[model samples]
Target: MSDSPDDSGALHLKHVLAAAGVTDLTDVFAIRHTAKNDGLPDLWTASPEAVLAYTREQDSRFRVFPENPPRSWLVFMDDGSHEGAHRSRFYGAYENDGEALSERTELNRSFHIKASPLLAAMKNRLVVEWTAPRRWHRRGTLAGDFRVLEIADPQVIPFVGYDKVRLTYQRLKAIVDDPHYSRWHSALSAVKGIYLISDTSNGKQYVGKADGGGGILGRWSAYAHNGHGWNKELAALPKGQCEHFIFSILRVFGPEAIQRQVDEAEGHFKEALLTRGKFGYNAN
Candidate 1:
């Protein structure tokens, strides 16, 4: 019964119910199922309140409540790291509205089915996660399989991976445009650094310094706007092709450092990154 849904009309929820040893799918308590879907671009990127608003669109009558709870539960998996693959797995769902289910905050949350048979079975086979996309729809009390939808892979999970961003010219735009990505933008803005921009097309590197009032974010903003950021050597190539540029932090400098020191550090990275001859894009 752990098999994923096939093109056939096989219901995944039925499989879950069977695994949970539930026979009749009667007055099943309908829980909200809000998952990442195609119709909304920034669905996962939204703030918690925004997400709550999106999920609360369902009719109040169908929403899950402690007093009018469902005897069973179900879900709809639209997209995830599974690459549109769907299968029942260990999950944890919670609501902090002082009602829905548990009032425990993210900092003090744990998923364990301490109750006997039925509740314990629900806990083991239940989908638990904060990623649901809709409030519990009371109408969907019947066990049903989730529909797997295709979406662009490598989904962007906010606050998950930012420190590792090797700034590309395109990604630079996101950093400037999206406040959610402001953590890196703010950190980079407060420091000085020697950065490396690699012309991924030719493997050429451009070593630059950002120690002025603007800091690294200021320097990168230029590249995001004008690819190559007015680098003489990069100017020789076509403009549209600058999309191949890759940026990354080479070295950071303390505020106490002077312009001359930053220039020296930039010089060091220029040599290290070999932006000189072997695809060296820096004319200077």
Candidate 2:
């Protein structure tokens, strides 16, 4: 293992390990890289041992090996100076060959820095380590960290599919009132067939294609009410929280057949939400 300053002149390290295959550790692990100080690319590494040592030094936490030979292990690191301190920003290690550890595996585990707590404490350098639990799986570890940054807020517009449709009933109720409502009202009437936004627990927000249309209400309602439908779903949901908002809508298909339009619109919405890190639905 070796350490050096990266392009931004931040201290970074890399590790190399002689392991069997990639799938030897945990099923899936993430690497978080933060800075020893506040900045970008705070985490860096090129090897597994480096990741392990970094995590141990930074957090001083470890888990007992599970398998006879220890299928996988992970390391987490941060640059903030605090004994046993947690930082939201950190790095992680994963098995080398793209293998991940199964959560079902019984392994003695402990954590020095919970991701949320770590993110709350420090804004400096951080890193993490992850391992898989299969011998035939990938080998080695992957390293990276996290950093806080600001992004520009997108310009959004409200979409009213049916001007005549009243908001008196719940939003889904309004949609169920008329199939034609989908034809006129869209999250993005300005764009043509694109309806990208939907109402969720957090008001108007981007939803996946699978969660697009009025389907979002159904799925969420199912989960919220222990499998209920319609009014019952709404009744079961926390009161005053079912209100939906129009975050942004896009119309990619213009005056196409209804089926074709649904397919196209759903695809476009899925692509858009995915690009923004909002993968909420199970497409399958």
Which residue window of length 10 is worst by lDDT in model 2? Answer: 144-153
What clash count does candidate 1 reach?
Answer: 18
- Model 1 misplacement above 4 A: 1-163
Candidate 1 per-residue lDDT over residues 177-282, each given as its tens digit: 6766655666777788888877767677778888777788888887787776676776777857678877777788777888888888887777766777755767
Relative to the unseen true structure, what is the C-alpha lDDT of residue 34 in candidate 2, on a scale of 0 to 100?
A: 39
Best by TM-score: 1
Candidate 1: C-alpha lDDT: 0.51
Look at candidate 2 and tell me the lDDT of residue 114: 24
| Model 2 vs. true fold: TM | 0.22
lDDT of 2 by residue, 1-284 (tens): 22333467443212111111233222333333433433222232223444443432222122322222222333333333234333232333322231133322233222232222222221223322222212212212333222222111222212223221223124444443444444333432323233333444543334332233433333332323432234332344465444442323343433333556667666666665563333432232
The C-alpha TM-scores of every prediction are: 0.44, 0.22
